[model samples]
Target: MLLEALTHTWPWYIAGPLIGLFVPLLQLVGDKQLGISGNLRHLCSALLPRRIDFLRYDWRGAGAWNLIFALGTLLGGWIGVHLLGTGEIAISPDTQASLHALGVHDLSGLVPHEIISWEGLLTVRGFVSVVAGGFLVGFGTAYAGGCTSGHAISGLSNFQLRSLFAVLGFFAGGLLATHLLLPLLF
Candidate 1:
């Protein structure tokens, strides 16, 4: 049933809030606060050669669930890509016109060129972009103490002011990086 929902009925509207509600409920029930960035600190503590910082909590306690979540995400993405079909990434007509105005004549070819290709994935530019983006996200997640979803959906629903600030900061930082800094640097 879950797989079917993933394949069929799970639109953004349903999936979005369901996730938001689930995270805090997990926190309420399990006594573990949810945040993606916290995992970075958690992970670093577990892997560091010298151990001095961690004196309170056990990293191993979080490991199993984290691994399971990681696996689920990987599996879901693969299924979404391959089995569920790469449905058109919807954008407003106005947004499409804006891309056209920006001299992007065709916005259709912008993603997943003929599905997941090893050649594409292994290409130096692609590999570097993925690695660099992943690294930055890791750093950001650590800095923010959560991913966008954790704050935007989970924390916001719980009426957390900190999460609101984090979400805003996330958007602001992303806009700065993508709009202002990325073209200059890349």
Candidate 2:
């Protein structure tokens, strides 16, 4: 079941690659792909941004399918946590030991909890970070002519070497941010 998969086996490394696989399959079937970064354009359209791009696409021409999909995602996530079970992934000792090397131990902020609840996964600080990060990601995706998923999934599937490079950059940027920058900021 989806709930079991989420609760028992979901991790970024696992989900990311599986999703990277799924996106291309969807693209092959629908001729369209998925990415979270583009949602900023939706938010921008909702806010009447200086650049009204999401509106120009006429997503409504899809008969509000986008809206339905949005609702489904939200509903599905809630069901996963509430109906199936709550998530509390235990961080690996390797991660904690690495944090130890970074002068972070069990200390607050400097060190993170080993086990994280779904809500704890989205603390106020985390939420703010998501908002700011989302904004930056939106800008980057727009500038890149496609988001990470588009590049890693749709573009890469066609053997576009550029997508491979972009994916590498994405991984590099994430490592730099999480390992180096985030600790400094927090």
Q: Give each model's whole-structure lDDT.
A: 0.65, 0.63
Best by TM-score: 1
- Backbone clash total for model 1 is 1
- Shift in Å, residue 140, candidate 2: 1.7
Clashing pairs in 1: 37-141
RMSD from true fold, candidate 1: 4.6
Poorly placed runs, candidate 1 (over 4 Å)? 1-10, 52-57, 97-129, 182-186
Cα RMSDs, all models:
4.6, 5.4
Instruction: Give the per-residue lDDT digits (tens) of candidate 1, residues 4-115.
Output: 6555546788877776676767677776555545556567767772746542457668654664565677797787778976555677898787545543444553354322
lDDT of 1: 0.65
- lDDT (Cα) of model 2: 0.63
The true-versus-predicted C-alpha distance at residue 116 of model 2, in Å, is 11
